[model samples]
Every structure is written in structure tokens, then in C-alpha cells.
Target chain A: MSRHARDDNVPLNADATSSRDLALEVENLRTVFHTEHEQIHAVDGISFNIRRGETVGLVGESGSGKSVTARSILGLIESPGEIDPASAIRFEGDNITEYTESEYESIRGDGIAMVFQDPLSTLNPVYTVGNQIKEALSLHQDLRGTAATERAIELLEEVGIPDAARRVTEYPHQFSGGMRQRAVIAMALACAPEVLICDEPTTALDVTIQAQIIDLLMDIQAERDLSILFITHDMGVIAEVADRVNVMYAGEIVESAPVEPLFAEPKHPYTRGLLRSIPSTQTSGDRLETIKGEVPTPNEPASSCRFAPRCPKSFEECSEVAPIPTAVGDDPDHDAACLLYPESMTTDEAVAHHRPADDGGEQ
Target chain B: MGRWEYFLKRVLLMVPIVFLGTTVTFLILRVGPIDPAAAIIGPSGDTEAYAAIRDSLGLDQPLWIQYAEFMRDLLTLQLGESWVVVRGQSVWELVGVYGPRTLWLGFWSILIPIFVGLPLGFYAGLNPNTLADYIASFGGIVWRAMPNFWLAVIFVSVLTQSDALFGFSWGDWLVETQIVTPPDLSGLWEPTQFLGALKAILPAALVLGSASMGNEMRIGRTAVLETKNANYVEMAKAKGVPGRLVVWKHMFRNALIPLVPVITGEAFLLLGGSVLVETVFAINGLGYLFFQATINGDVPLVGSLMFLFILLSVGINILQDFLYTVIDPRVGYDGGA
Candidate 1:
């Protein structure tokens, strides 16, 4: 790789060493979509960071703004997608907001790459896998026909494609579901980006294929020291691979903590509900506990805490004002937007008073 | 039976239908309010003179007898003479004379529409939201809305004043005939009259071309747009495929497959519409003959023209099916084909 000059135009602070070590830092990012009727704040002031050589999973149910947050970081949102001025997506110490579309192209596949959910739709039907991969390689690397093709074959092999030489020549449709996804991964890995955004990449695959893909991604991440922002609704998958977890609800990150701490004691009621809802043999009830109500659409601006309506531990204080980030315990890293803490609790402790009775009744 | 077998059986069944179409045409012409024998009686015939002429011309015969005689003559390709217009010209000879001109005009005119319209539509589809799509779409609507007669008048008026259109000017019709004749069939490159015939080809082709091309462009735009939004296209975009390759290879090839039937239908439409176009342009093509027949109340000529169109329609439909099978293998004769 060439020792290319870093863009001088990026806003920087020499003393702000904290942001430099991170591959991507999204600071209070909010994305709103303007429709004919109203403005929807899909990603409402969600903040997270992915460091080099780490995998961070954003877990949420449908309409959780998990995908929107990832797309916003990549600048993939089209017209009507309104990002607030306050939000800053700092990629490798460079605020991405400073780059125009043409300049954004430099960071898109090179600085940070993204792999979409559907593998079948991700590869152009007309071009061979080799051609598609080679095109991306050539874009970031200056290589001609044969050299680019050789590199493409190497990528296919790296992604564990059998008969990579011959399979590279085949079009996307000819490949099975698993192989197409492997091919997509191969394309994403071709440029050797600093960070990779996998948006539910394994969600479309079967159980066996999903395991293979997850393993492939892990292997690639180890080899490249790549930071990955993995987005999925599956907590089990998060438990399997993620070092850190960000739990989002209705377009806002409700709780974020280290994986072990989050799995041990979920701070937010919404997070507890989500973890309980995951189907498992040990939780041998006829019905799994579900988070009540649907995720609110952006059309209706969320007031107070967005998840307050669905939170089982909601009290009158929950609806009075919007929840702010409050430490659940002494650990500064472990935080949630809930009034569960004693000093933070304002007004009648109606829900907390019912807690002991609820526990006894359940037993 | 499979679709092909069923289709073949249906087509075979249409042989009788075609024969019926001809028979009905003959009967309708016979029952028309004009007298066929009036011209034969020298236009000064008394009632008794008309009766003698009718007897000789077989007009006095019973309806069944006349039908039987007509059937025999049709089978033998010996159509009887027209009573008016070409007073002594055998219907077969007259058809032989006029059919070639009409067929030639129809063939070229249809080709003009397909070649111009499809590409224009494709370009428009590729560049949606750009000036190209807007211009092509607007042009398509304008041409489609204009009547063939109105188009013909404008084309003639413009061509006559300019004396040239796209580097070709109106020439005498003698060139096509000389080229088709025996001595010239030996491959002498007769460029003079051929170029001249091609000159007026513009107006006829333009009128037919505008109508069919406009319709084809609209369909092409839709196909291209739908294809552009296909999942594979998104993949291609992510894969960093250039815009041109994405449009041409990914979207275009797939999109064009669905348009095979529409293109074939346009061919037939242009061919039929050319008749009106030719009359309006004052081109001495088969359309002129049909127009003259209608104006002069030449029922036999009019009936034959309508019958010829039915045959053309059936032939074009068959060609369309064949093209569809060729374009898409998934569309089989048995089911989706």
C-alpha cells in the first residue's frame, strides 16, 4: 500500500487521542427521513464505536434503526434521507461529513466496506463472480486484466470457495446460496478495508450455511485485523462473535456494554425483554416472552423514552421526560437510558414497588 | 396435448376459418347496393339489357351456385374479373400487381419503426431523470398522439419544400420495378432508381415509424426501469460495475427479452398503418389501391384488401410466437411460452 497523504481537509484535534484509535466513531448520530407527511428520525442520536481488530454487534428487533444507523455511516441513504448537523461519523479520525459523494467514494470501499443482507441480490446476474470481484479490486488497486483476474481468484479462494479457479468464471446464479454469499464476502474483502459493515449477512442463509459464513467472516477478520460493525436481531449470534454489544430500540440505542456484562445483567427493561424473547430449550415455556407493541414509525415523533410504552418496568416518571444516558452502576462503560437507578428515579416508585410482588407471583 | 400440439391444431383449425373469412368477404361484396352488370351493359342498359348481362356474368345464378363457383375459382387461384375499377383485370392479376408494392412498403416501414423506436426507448430508460429520458419520452408521446394522416401531410409538406430528408429525396417508383424485373435480377447494381425509391421511403416509413416507434419506446422505458431495479443490478452497483456495462449487459439484455412480443406486434401495426400513411402521402403503394377502391366503391377490390390483411395478421402473430421462444428459453411452448 502506498503511503498516501492523509486528507488535510478533515477536521482534526491532535490532542483528541481517543477518536484516533477507533476505526469508526459515530457521535450522537441522528438520521431523519422526510416524507410527504412528516419527518421520521430513524436513527435518533445513537452513538457507538468500533475499534480495530474487534467485532461489535448492534442487536435489535425489526424497525430498531440498526440498519439505518449502518447505512447512515456508509452514506448510503438516498434523497429524503436527512442527517442532522450535529451528528458526526468519524472514520479513521476523518469526519466523513466533510467529504462529498465523489470524495466519499474513496472511503466507501477502501476505508470501510459494507456487505448487504441478500447475497443473491448483491452480485450482478450478468457478470461472472470473478469479473465482479476483479472490478472491485481494480478500482482500489491498479491492475490490468490478467493480474486483476489472478487477484480475484485468490480472493475467491480466501473466502473458501471450492474450485475457485473455475467457480470464479461462473455467474452469480450458478452458485448456491452459500457460495454467492462467500463471493460477496470475497468482494468486500478484496480492498482490505479497515472496517467492514455486515448488515445481517448471515440472516438469509440456512443453519449450516450460516455457521460456515460466520466462521469465514471470523477467519477473515483475524487475518486482516478488520473492525466489523455487525448488525443482526439475533442475540445468540451476538453472543457468539461480538466483544461488545449495543442494544437498540425504536431507532435509539437503549443499552450498550461489554458482551459479558450485558449477557449477565441487562440494564434496560427492553434489553431484558429482547434477551428473554430469544427462543431456547432452557426457557421451556409454551410461549416466549415478547416485547409488547410494535416499533414506532418515524412519522410519530418519539417523546420521552421511545421504548417506555413497551418497557415492563415503566412508571409515571418514564413518560414525563425523555430518558437520558444514566449509569446503571459504578461502571462508566455500562449505561442505559432508564430511571432504574435510585437517585435518578423521580416521582412515585409505582413500578419498583410492584417488582417484589411480581417476582413472588411468577415463582 | 402440449401447447405446441394444441397450438398447431388450432392453427390447422384456422385454415377453415381463413376460408370462411374469404367466403364471407365474397358474399358481402355480392350483396352490395351497386350493380356489377351496369358497366358490362355499357352504362346505357335497360332492365332487359341488365338481365342479359347478369346472366352472362353469372350474377343471375342462384346464391349457392355462385358460392360454389367462387369456391372453385378461389381453389384454382383463378379469381374472376372485377366489374369496375380494373373493369377487365382479373382479381388475381390485380392482387399480384398491387400486393408487392404494399408488402414492400410495409416491410421497410415496419423495419424503420423497430430500429428507431427500440433504441430510443432503451436510451430513455437508461437515463431516467435526465434530459435524455425526458426528451425521448416527450418525443414518443407527441408522435404517438399524432394521427397517421396528419403525420403524412406534415411529412409530405416538409419533404416537398426541402427536396431532401436525411440525404434522400423522392424519386420515381420505376426503380423498384426495374430492380425486381428479370434482366436486372442478374445482379446489376442499379443504384439510380433504387436510391430514388428509397427517397420517398422516408415519408411512408416516418408515418408508420412514428406511431409504432412511439409505442415501442414507452414499453421499452418501462421494461428498462423495472429491470434497472432488479436485485442483480444492486449487486452490480456494489460490485463496482461501470454504469454503461450495468445498463447494457445487466438491464438491457434481460429487459429486451420481455419486449419480443411487443416488437413483433409493432411490426404488424406499422405494416397495416402504412396503408393509410401511403394514401395520405400520395404514394402509389398497395394502400393507394385500397384507398382508390374504397372511394370508387370497388367492393371486390376492397374485400380482397381486407382479406389480405387478415392473412398478414396471422403470419405476423406466428412470427411473434417464434421470436418469443427464441428470446427466452424459460418461456416454453408447453406452459409459459
Candidate 2:
């Protein structure tokens, strides 16, 4: 991956900052999946919070624990998956992480609903779209019979499914990929949940539909004051919707910042590589830059910086010691986990001062 | 539009499938060494008598004309008279009389597995890897492995034997044990006529239903297990649906989708089993008559019986296809479209 020099002059995007009520808080989440011989540390001690009406993006490549983090929050993790006891998932001041299955049942899709990546799988094929949506309405909202049916139709209409009255009677297979996704979104928002975790909800759609879905989510989030944990591998998507972006690598948050700064001046080399790799009109003629190595499965606890093997700017210390997430740059919100930010990274002058002569890029 | 259209298409497709099945049987019967004419004339009849029989019966006619007549008779349900087993009796009339008994046996057989196997399997599935599952699974295997003929014989012999301590036969004991409000000494008198009737067929039905019951049990468990993990099921649970509703509303129907074909396909298996079961139980059902007709070279009787079996099997398969479309909307019969 080529080194991306920070654009020092771009002003901050003010829309990305909002000091609102904390809707959901996740602390020290370490999700591990046990196999016969090893435990896959899928989400390793990651923490973040979404304020009411804010969209927090957990951005990562496949196998980088984004989906696991979402599942863990919902208490949806099944057998072989074990969340570390220290993990705390707080929603509106309630630490729901310790809830029993029945307790979780009351919260899921009521307090915090989710929209999965594949809408076809998310909606039951045997049931009509209206019936499935009514299920959620009845379960969490106490709307029943005609009332639930009417609410389902309304929700479907609100999500932009045309002729909702007619389409509600149809099955999932009868709808197009995008329409199915809309139905799923409608189902998630049926009870007017406070927190919505969208796990790669647009990854299966075409570019236009993806944009539409993102827009629909943002519009709904605004009207409902919904706090969203939008998980995706698409940095472009994170750019479009996320207020605060958490860039995850190998089960750890490598960078966290307001989306604009994270884009314009990514501190962690991994974050820089992710930003540089997105397809851009300016880089149309250039071969796309790619982070060269796969994200390790992390079967063993992190002994050193996991990204050091592929990090272009990784020094000898990167292979010897792991980096913890430390504040980077002047923004109090921004943090990056890299040995380069031994303390809270302060400024570019310090970065340049610390850089070795041979390894510093063209900048 | 797709559902009704698909159902109509499948119903129509049944024509060629049944026709082809009957046609193959016709060709085999016609080309085989057994001459119906000789069988009709018998050993004492002269050569002239044989030729007269052949000519009169249209056995001398060309093969295509015979096949056309056969097809016509099948369509019109004008199956010819029986030759030897019940000489000169109309095959249709014979089947009409005998069909109900076998059907009764079949009904119980079907009901037995659906009630017994499916619930056991589902129970096992609900508590998979538990002791309950293992016991149910093991019992199913043991029952399935017992041959119907052997099991039928054993049941009949065992059921007919007198319980010396009680001074009543096992069958009588069963009838007496039924939860019927009866006169205290009703065991010797009426002992519930329905249970008495059930006693007569229960051994055979149980034996016949055993294999299918076992099969359904194993399959039911698998279907439940597979469907519980399906994405839709997960979605239902994630919706905070009560666990019971999740199983009943979401999992049950999806689980039954796989079992529909397996259950409907049991009809064909039952037909083959009925012959042995009928012989062992001494039930004068169609299967027993079929066995007798086949042994006695009752050509017309055999042909009609075989064709009827074909019709029933084809009908069963059509039912299976229809059930599939009903259970799972995605699986439509798009054949010949």
C-alpha cells in the first residue's frame, strides 16, 4: 500500500459532530468462537458508543469482526461463539450484556433491531412481507390483527416500496433484491427502535440501490432519532452515512475519528491504506492501491501489532510490541492504534520528527 | 397466478406419466410368454377352443389396436372381467369391493407414522443429542429393521394367544383395555366394536407403518435440525419472537417442507408392503387378491390390479408435488412451461 500524506488544510465537516444522549454503549467486547482446537478471537476488546441520532460506522474488510460485533450486541451469538464476561453492552443506561435469553428477546428488534446484508435470508420466504413485518409489530409494539397489518403496510410505504398495500401481500421471493432489502428495513424499523445495527445491509445491492438504501436509512434515522451502528467493508459507504468511523483490523479498532478527519487525515497506516484503496475518479488511471496481506484469524492473543506484517510504514518496534488505541491529532475524538502515536499523537511536526529517513514516503 | 397455474400444469402432467406407466405394463403383458388364450381355454380344451378364445377376445388383433383399447378401458374405468381368481367377475366390481379394506389398512398405516413417527422425531429434534433423542432414534431403527411379513406373523400369533392369568386372548385384552365406558364383563360380550375392528387390523397396520414411521422419525429430526439453523429462523428469533412461536410459526412449516415428499412417498412403499402384510394377516384385501391372481395366471385380474396400483402411485406422486408447492411457495411445478 502506498503511503497517503494527510491533507493538512481541509476544514472539519461540522455535520459529523453531535454531543447527544448515549443510546448504545459497547465496552471491552471480546467475542471468541471456539473450534475443537482453537478459539477464533473474532472481536477483540473493541469499544464504541453511538449517541442518539448519530450513525457510528464500524468499517472493516471481511473477517475483521464487524458482523461479530453487531451479533454480540444483539445477544444473537449462537453455540461455539463466546463473548468474554467483561464485555458490557449498555443501551439507554441498562447494561443488557448480562441479560438472559428471554430478556434479550424482549430487547432485540424492540429496543435494538438489525438489518442483515442479505435481505432474502433476513425475511422468511414462507410468509408474506406484511405478515413478517406484522410479526415484529405484534411482538414488540403490541399491534395486532388489522392494526398490525395496517402498520406493516405503512412501514412498507415509509421504506419506499411502491404500492405498499399490494406489495405487502407478496412473498420475499416475489420482490426484487432491492425491494426485499426495503422490506427488511421496514421490519427493523417496525417498532421504532432506538438503536439499529445495520450489518452490511447494502453490500448485496447494485451501486444505485446501495445509495438509495443508505439515503433511506439516513432519512429514517433523522425522523426517528435512531442511533445506528452501521457496519460495512465499504469506506465509501462509511463516508456517506457515518458520523464517527471506527476502522477495525484483526478484531481491533485501529482508528476512530469523525468521518471527515478519518478520510482526509487517517493516522493509522491501516486506515490510510483503506482510504487510499477506495475507487476514486482522481485515481481512475492508476492501479488501485491494496493492503497486501489478509487479516489474520487471531487464533492466538495479539503478541505484537497484527497489521505490522502488511503495514508499509511498520518499523522494528511494530513487530515487537502491540499498539493500543491512543489519541491522534488535535481532535479529541480521533484515536489511532499505532506505536507512532506512543502517547496521544499531537501534530504533523512530531510525526515527521519521529519518522526515520529511509522509510518516510515522498511527503 | 403462479400457484393455480402450477397446480393445473402438474395435474395435466399426470396424464402422460400415468399413460406411459400403463403402456409399459401393456407392452410387457402382451410380449410375455404367458398366453391369456391358453390360460382361458385350460388343459382340457381342444386347439380349436384356444383359437376361438383368442379370436373372440381380440387377442389376434394387432398390438396397437389392443393398446388403444387398453388405454380407452383405463380412461373409462371399464376394466374387463376377471379370468380365474374370481372367474367372470368384473375387475372393477372386484376392486370396488376389495379396495376399501386395503385403503382402511393404508389409512391406519399412514396415520400411525404421521402421528407416531413425526412427533417422536420432532421431540427428538427439539432436544437433539439428549437421551430422549437417542432412545427415539434407536427405537425407530429397531422397528424399521423388522420385516413387515415377520412382524405381522409374530403380532397375529402373539395377539391371538390366551393370557392364562387373565383367561383372555391378547387381542381381547387390548379391546377390553380401551378407554370405553363398558359393562364390567364387556370383554366377553361387545368390548367396543371399534377396538375389536382395530384389533384385527392394528397388527398389520403397525407392521406396515413401522418402516415408514422409523423413516419419518429420522427425517423429521433432520428436517427440524436443518431448518432451525436456516437464516429465516434466525431472523424470526432476532425479531424477539417467543421461542414457542418461533418453533410453531416459523420452524414447523419450513421443517415440514422437507418431510412432505418423504411422507407422500410413503404411499408407494405401503403398496408393496400391503401384499406381504395381507398374506400374513389372512386379510382378503386387494393385495391378497393380487397375489392370488398373479399366482393363478388370472391375466385380466392381474392387469387391472397392476394398472390400479400404477394409478394410485401416480396419484400419490402428484399429491407430493402439490404439497411441495403448498408448503414452499418458491418450489413451483414449472414443468412443460
Interface RMSD of each: 5.2, 3.4
> Highest lDDT: which candidate?
2
TM-score (0 to 1) for chain A, all models?
A: 0.88, 0.89
TM-score leader? 2
| Poorest lDDT segment (10 consecutive residues) of candidate 2 chain A | A1-10
lDDT of 2 by residue, A1-363 (tens): 101112111113224533236788777788999999999999988878788788999998999999999989989898789898877778866788888999988888888888898886877878888999998888788999998988998999999998999998888888888999999999998866889999999999999999999999999998998899999999889999999999999898888899888888889999988888887824566688888979988898775789999999887767655565666787878878687874443434334433433445122
In model 2, the Cα lDDT at residue B263 comes to 89
Error of 2 at A169 (Å): 1.0
Instruction: Give the true-structure RMSD of model 1.
Output: 9.2
By TM-score, how accurate is candidate 2?
0.87
Candidate 1 regions exceeding 4 Å error are: A1-17, A300-302, A329-331, A341-363, B1-142, B145-199, B239-257, B286-337
DockQ of each: 0.20, 0.40
Report the CA-based lDDT of candidate 1 relative to the real structure: 0.72
**Where does candidate 1 chain A have its weakest 10-residue lDDT segment?**
A1-10
